[model samples]
Every structure is written in C-alpha cells, then in structure tokens.
Target: MELKIDESIIKAYGFTHQNINIQQIGSGHINGTYLLTKLPSNEKFVLQYINTNVFTNPKAIANNIQAVASFLNQQFPTYLFPAPLLTVNGENMATYNGSYWRLSPFVDDTVALDTLSSPKQAYEAAKQFGKLSRLLNGFDSNKLQATIIGFHDLVLRFEQFENALANANTAFKTKAAEEIEAAINYQYILNNYLEIKDVLPDRVMHHDTKISNVLLDQNSYEGVCVIDLDTLMPGKFISDLGDMMRTYLCEFSENETDFSKINIREDYFAAMIEGYLYEMGSILTKKEKEAILFSGKYIIYMQALRFLSDYLNGSVYYPIHYPTQNLDRAKNQLKLLQELVDNEEKLQDIINQSLLKVI
Candidate 1:
C-alpha cells in the first residue's frame, strides 16, 4: 500500500540527507508509522502521525516523551530510548495539515517480536520494563500529562461496560448474553481496584506494556529498549504489570477464535515474575509486592470488559476485522482470565519464590 507522505513535513525536521525514501511499517493500531531512510547515508528514522482523536493534546505526548527521555539519559545513560527529533523550529513535534507528526532515530540491529518465542525472551522483556519503572521511580510523575484520561481506571471501564450493555441493540444483546454475564461475574475485580486505589502508588507507567513494545537485540535476543512512549503517564504499577501479563503470558493473541489456544503459559509467567521482580523488587513496598500476582487478573478482566463493551456499543473504540471480532476477543480474554484465576495459587507461589531469590 502506498502511504501519502507530506514532503513539507519531512523537510520541517531539517534533515541533511539528500536522498530519502519513506514506507509504512509495523502493525500499530493507534498511530500511522513509517520508516524514512536516507539513501547515500543509509541513515534511518521512524516518523509517526499521532492519532489526535485518541490523544487530544499531541504536544502533551511530545512533552511526556521529551521529559522521560531526558530523565533516562541523565539517570540511566546506558539505557536506550528513542528520543523525539526536534523540528527546524526546535519543536519536538510539528502540526502539518491538521495532523501531529514526530520523528526519532531508528535503532538498528533490533526486532520487536509480537509474541514470546522463548522464556528467556519473556524474562528480558519483563526485566527491561521493570528496569524502566525502577529507573524513573524518582522522577515526578505529575510532570507528565495523561494522554488519555481515565485510561486504566477499571471503575470507569466497568461503568462504560454497564452503560453499553443497557443500551445495546437487541441483536447484540441477544448474541452476547453469555459474554455479558461472564463479564458481570467478574465485577469483584474492579472492586479490588477501588479498594486498593488508596494504597497503590501512582508511578510513571508504560500503560502499553505489550511484548511488541520492547525492542530485542537481533543477535543476543536481549531487550534493548522499550518503545511506544505515547502511553507514558502516571498510573498504578499494576497497570504496567497487568498489561504485560495480558499480552505476554497468553499463548494466543486476544483475537484468537480457538479457545483451546488461549491458555496462559506458566513458564512464561514465571519468567515474567522473576525478571520483573529482579529489577523492581527492591523498590516495591510489602503491599505492592503482595498485589503483584493479582495484576494479571485485574488487567485481563478489565480488557475483557473493554472488548465486550465495544462489541455491545457497535465496535466504536477498537477496529474490528469482522462483525464478531470484538466478541471473539472478549471471549478470548475471559478465557485467559479464568485460567489466571484457576492458577492464582501457582502464580502467587511464583511471585513469592521470585521475590525470595531477589532477597
């Protein structure tokens, strides 16, 4: 597919490369991403068009990245973060044709895997994410802007699900009766968030902690950097850990039709716990440590609710491939949630054992 590139937007970045080529890359759901390569120099960069509809303030997104990058550079100079390139006018982002755009130097010799191919990969990814949280622990999270307000608020998500169910069309209501009941059966999960909100420390969270967001070294298979900084904001530690569990532990993607393929991998779960706790265990309080295992259940149930809500509301939020895609995704998540619930004791054991090793 040919992506339309605004040459003026590229020139605004004031690149000295004479020959440039641009092509769309990645399967990102939120923003439009492209690879811009300079021919003679062979230099490459990633240019992204921010999804303004989801993020009302594009400049705020840039500001958050800039702040986080600066902090990481100063504190953990060895860590690699894709710092946003400044435009000719010294702006981190530019508005062209009513769209927001930003650029960053591409890290070569690395790949972003969509799934965990090995337990080592899982450990590396988790360690990198946990390291990011630990490194930024001292940074004031209030300085960052909430790109999407109420993004990880489970209470708000539950309310939206209830509202969608009440007003759903008859066909949807009839077809999704089982899923709706399953969602409501897990209302206690949202209740847990409300009960613990007071104690859960609000830290700088990488709200989107999917495996794909962590770039892995092509040769060593170690995690190099955590990409996709658009969702960086102040949030509960569970939000980051839960998101990792949601995406990393599952053997199948959220949209899988085969229920049998949706089981959580215990080995991967152990790796995640061991790796995350290795970096973050020292900083986490006793309460936070106790709550770590439950983060998976919290995020999975919330995601199921979000998917079912979108399905009931005529699939407005997430893009759907088929008419029943959202419904299938909801079912997949619910199945994963059930697995987590069944293995809750085992997961807690892993967490406990992992923490003990760190001690």
Candidate 2:
C-alpha cells in the first residue's frame, strides 16, 4: 500500500546516511509502521504515524515513552529498548499534515513474530516482560501519564459494558443474549482487579503484551526488547502478566472462528510461569503471588466484555470486518475464558511449582 508521507517529515529526523529506503512492515492492527533503511550502512529505524483516533493526546504518549526510556537507560543500559528518535527541532514526536509521527532506531538482528512459534519463544517473551516490570519496580509510576485514560480500569469497563447492554437495540440484544448472559455470569472474574488493587503494589506495566510486541534475536530466539510502548502506564503487575497469559498461552489467536482450536496450552502456560517468576517471584508479595493464576481469567474475561460491549453498541469502538465479527470475537474470548477456568487448578499448580523452583 502506498503511504502519502511527505519527504520533509523524513528529512526532519536528520539521518546522516546518503540514501534511505522506507517500507511498511509488520501486521499491526493500530497505527501505520514503516522500516527506514539507510544505504551503505544498512542501518534501519522504525517510523510510525501515531493513531490519533485511538490516542487523543500524542504529546502525552510521547512523554510516557520518554520517561520510561530515560529511566530504563539509566537503570539498565544493557537492556534493548526502542528509544524515540528526536526530530531536528529536538522533539520526540512531530506534527505534519495534522498527523503525529515518531521514530526509533530499530533493534538490529532481531525478529518479532506475530504468534508464538514455540514454547521457548513464549518463555523468552514472558521473561523479557517480567524483567521489564522488575527493572521498573523502583520507578515512580504516578509520574507517568495515562496515554489512554481508563485504559485498564476494570470498574469503568464493567460500567461501559452495562451501559452498552442496557442501551442496545432490541434486535442486537436478542442476538447477543447468550453472550451477554455469559458475560454477566462472569462479572466476578473482572471484579478480581478491584479486590487485589489495594493489596498489590501499582507499578509500570506494558499493558499490551502480545507476542508481536516482543523482539527476539533472529538466531538464538532470545527475547531482546519489549517494544510497543504506547500503553506504558501505571497499573497492576498482574495485568501485564495476565496479558502474557491471555496472548501467549492461547493455542490460537482471539479472532479464530474455530472455538475448538482455542484451548489454553498447558505447556506454554508452564513455560510462561517459569520465565515470569524467574524475574518476579522474589518481589511479588504473598497476596500478589496468590492472585497470579487468576490474572489470566481477569484479562480474558475483561477482553470478552469489551468485545461484547462493542458488538452490542453497533461496533463503534473496534473496526469490524463483518456485521457479527465482534460477536464472533466475543464468543472466542469467552470460550478461551471457559477453558482457562476449567484448567485453573492445573495452572495454579504450574505457578506453585515454578515458584518453588525459583525459591
């Protein structure tokens, strides 16, 4: 696809290379991303147009990235983080043609997979995310801005779901009645966040922990960096780990239509726990450790609620390919949630065993 980005925008970043080549890369659902390669040196960088529709305040997002990157640079210089590239004006982000843009030097010799190709990949991704949390344990979370207001506020999500269900058209409500009832029955799972928020210490969380967000070494498959810092903000550590569970442990993507293919992979779950607790085990309090397994249930059900809410409300929030795509996604997540519930004991056992190993 041809993008209409201006050459001046590229030049503003001040690349010293003589010739540059830019091409779109990745399967990102949000925001447009391109890989910029400098000739001769073959050094590459990532330039992205911030999706303003999803993020209303580009400056706030830039500020969050800068803060997190600055802290990480000082505390863990060896860690690979995609720090934002500054423009000639000395700004992390620039406004051009009424759109926001940012740049970051690409991590060399690393690959980001759209899905987990192996249990090792799952473990590596989990370890990197967990290590990131551990590194930021001392950083002040309140100083970070909420790039997306109420991004992970479960109480607000429930309220929005309730409003959407109440205001839903009769035909729409009737069609999604079964899913709505399933969501209502599982309100307790979503409420887990409220119960644990007071006990668990709030820290910097990478709210989006999908496998694609992690970059792995091309040869060794070792996870090198945790990219996609748009959703970096103050939140529960479980939410971040839960996202790892929701995305990595699953046998299929959330959009898969075949419900039978959506079972939680027990091996992947075990690997994730082993990798996560390797970094987080000692730091997590008794209460936090106890709540570890349920984190998966919480995030999975919360996602289902969000999908169902959007479907009932005429799919305003998420882009839908078909009329009932959101409904299908809702059912997919609910099915995954049910599988996670069925295997809750087994998952808890894995967590306990992994914790034992670390201890």
TM-score of each: 0.97, 0.96
State how far residue 255 of model 1 sits from its true place (Å): 0.9
List where candidate 2 sits over 4 angstroms from the true fold: 15-18
Looking at candidate 2, what is the lDDT of residue 169?
A: 97
lDDT for 325 (candidate 1): 94
User: What's the true lDDT of residue 347 in model 2?
Assistant: 81
In candidate 1, which residue pairs clash? Answer: none
What CA RMSD would you report for each candidate? 1.4, 1.6
Deviation of model 2 at 167, angstroms: 1.0
Which regions of candidate 1 are displaced past 4 Å? 16-18
Candidate 2: 10-residue stretch with minimal lDDT:
1-10
